[model samples]
Target: MTDTAIQTRQREIASEHLLFKLIEYVEDRHPGLLDFLEQSLDHLGDPADDASKDDAGVRAIAQRMITGARRQGTD
Candidate 1:
């Protein structure tokens, strides 16, 4: 494959792996957290945007997930 093709394929694979990891993390920890993340990611205008909105959304989700996981652990 050409370099461009290879890069495209690599990006596709990486996105797939990231999605899988997110799913596994949610399933094994917080059941509905993936949906929350998806909602946040979907509302963003651009993935490359530097508006800080994406970071804020992701951080909020991460905090919620962490709190849920910790509560589960202590239960």
Candidate 2:
């Protein structure tokens, strides 16, 4: 596969991993956290979307997820 295609696939995998981790976290702690994450993810739109490939956009989405997870973990 092309490098770009490979990178996209990797990002998708990472996103899935993050989603799984979020779900696991909710199961272990606060159920409401999942709802917040789902809202955040929805706001992020499709990872494969052209705008999502922009470096800043990707970082923003990842950062948001990480921040949400960290906040949930601490609570």
Candidate 3:
């Protein structure tokens, strides 16, 4: 493989590892949060929804996920 391909694969693996850790942490602290996020994402591509709403939803979910993952305590 080329140098760029190797780097890309390394990054993908690292990202997957980090994502798994985040999911495990989130699940342990707040069960069912991932499920709710999956459902919310499913609606983002709905024909009834406008581009602005989709953008807002994506941003909201990203913010919530980041905040939720880093939040301390049982909150």
Best candidate per TM-score, number?
3
Q: Please, what are the lDDT tens digits per residue for candidate 2 over residues 1-75?
A: 999999999999998777857565665676575456555653553347554466556557656665666655632
> What overall lDDT, based on C-alpha atoms, would model 2 receive against the true structure?
0.64
Among residues 3 or more apart in sequence or in different chains, the pairs in candidate 3 whose N, CA or C atoms overlap within 3 Å are none
Question: Using Cα atoms with residue i matched to residue i, what is each candidate's TM-score against the true structure?
Answer: 0.39, 0.40, 0.52
* Candidate-wise lDDT, in order: 0.60, 0.64, 0.64
Q: What's the alpha carbon RMSD for model 1?
A: 9.6
Cα error, candidate 3, residue 45 (Å): 7.0
Q: Which RMSD values do the candidates have, in order?
A: 9.6, 8.8, 9.6
- Score residue 6 of candidate 1 by CA lDDT: 98
Pairs that clash in candidate 2: none
Model 3 misplaced regions, further than 4 Å? 43-75
- Overlapping backbone residue pairs in candidate 3 total 0
Q: 18-74, model 1: which lDDT tens digit per residue? A: 755656665567667656655565454424555553655656655565455535532
**Model 2 RMSD to the real structure?**
8.8
